[model samples]
Target: MTDPAIPLGEIVLPCLNEARALPWVLSRIPDGWRAVVVDNGSTDGSAGIARDLGARVVHEPRRGFGAACHAGLLAAEAEIVAFCDCDASLDPGAAERIAAPVRQGSADLVLARRRPTGRGAWPLHARAGNLALARMVRRRTGLGLRDLGPLRAARRRALLELGLTDRRSGYPLQMVVRAADAGWRVEETEVPYRPRTGRSKVTGTWRGTWQTVHDMRKVLR
Candidate 1:
């Protein structure tokens, strides 16, 4: 049966050196929904793989996750915009859940909460840090979000109305906080999260983690 909640729109994938996982990610997407892949200066052939898999590719030279996401969002020509990491951690079917609230006109933004599907999926520190950040967000903005996970869906108009300015790595937190501050109806849904295909950009490296934290701090203020 056709999902009544799935919006007629496109999904945007922001990628960097994700050639190995692109095909798997593309294959999981349901038919009738198009995808736009934003290649953020990938040294590998991630763009080529995406193109071969029938995804429209956009090149963004800037090396920031937020920048890539913003570029993809602007390029999307759909009413509802879904964004996911190209690493395949998020279940593709969860897109329907994320878009459901928006399609029903009940929420402007839907954030996915990631629950580890198996052992050794998410590192201990990362999980703890994410929970702490979520708590902090709830305390500051009075908006409870389970996870600022990469899997998310929102109305394009509502996203634009939030006036997102952070073009760095902290884009996810910035987006949620801004949406809450704008009084947008935000909802959360549980999504299964598995380990990615390649090395994690943020948690795998200390430099990446530090940079992410710094960027997040800058945007939180």
Candidate 2:
């Protein structure tokens, strides 16, 4: 029951030193879907790996996660765009799930809520932050988000209409808030979130955690 409005779109993966996991992530993408990999100044050969795997490479010198994602969105030709992390934390096939609501014209933005399955995978602090952010988003925007996860899909027109302008680590939450404020139809899918292949840039570092919280609060305000 694939939604018909789900036009052929591009998948954007933001990579920063993800050489080890890029191959697996790229390989898992379903055929016929174009991919754009934004290399956020990776010292590793992540951009090269993505290019070799048939992804259109976009160089984003900026270090922010949102910057890389925004670059990919601008580079993509597809009307519908999907953004996901390059750490292999999400299922590639789940793109279909995100696209379903859009295809049916029921939603313009589809966010994947991570339902962690494996033992001791997601860190406690990260989980707490995710839950707190979701609560704040629901309270502030009246948009119920199960999680502020990386895997999400949206139509280009809707994204632009929402003015999704977070060019930093808190981009996910910002986009959701803007979409809600703009009255875009939004949906959330419960997808499994696995442990990433490499060290997570945000969840694995204290500075990143603080920056994420601070930026998210700004977005909320």
Candidate 1 overall lDDT versus native: 0.83
Roughly what TM-score does model 1 have, to 2 decimal places?
0.93
Looking at model 1, which ten-residue stretch has the lowest summed lDDT? Answer: 1-10
Cα error of candidate 1 at position 192, Å: 0.6
- Kindly list the per-residue Cα lDDT of model 2 for residues 11-95, writing each as its tens digit: 8998899999988888878656777899999998998889998888999997888899888888877777888888988877678
Q: List all candidate RMSDs to the true structure.
A: 3.2, 3.2
Q: Give every collision pair in model 2.
A: 5-103, 6-103
lDDT tens digits, residue span 169-201, model 1? 789889988888888888888888898888888
TM-score of every candidate: 0.93, 0.93
Q: Weakest 10 consecutive residues, lDDT, candidate 2?
A: 1-10
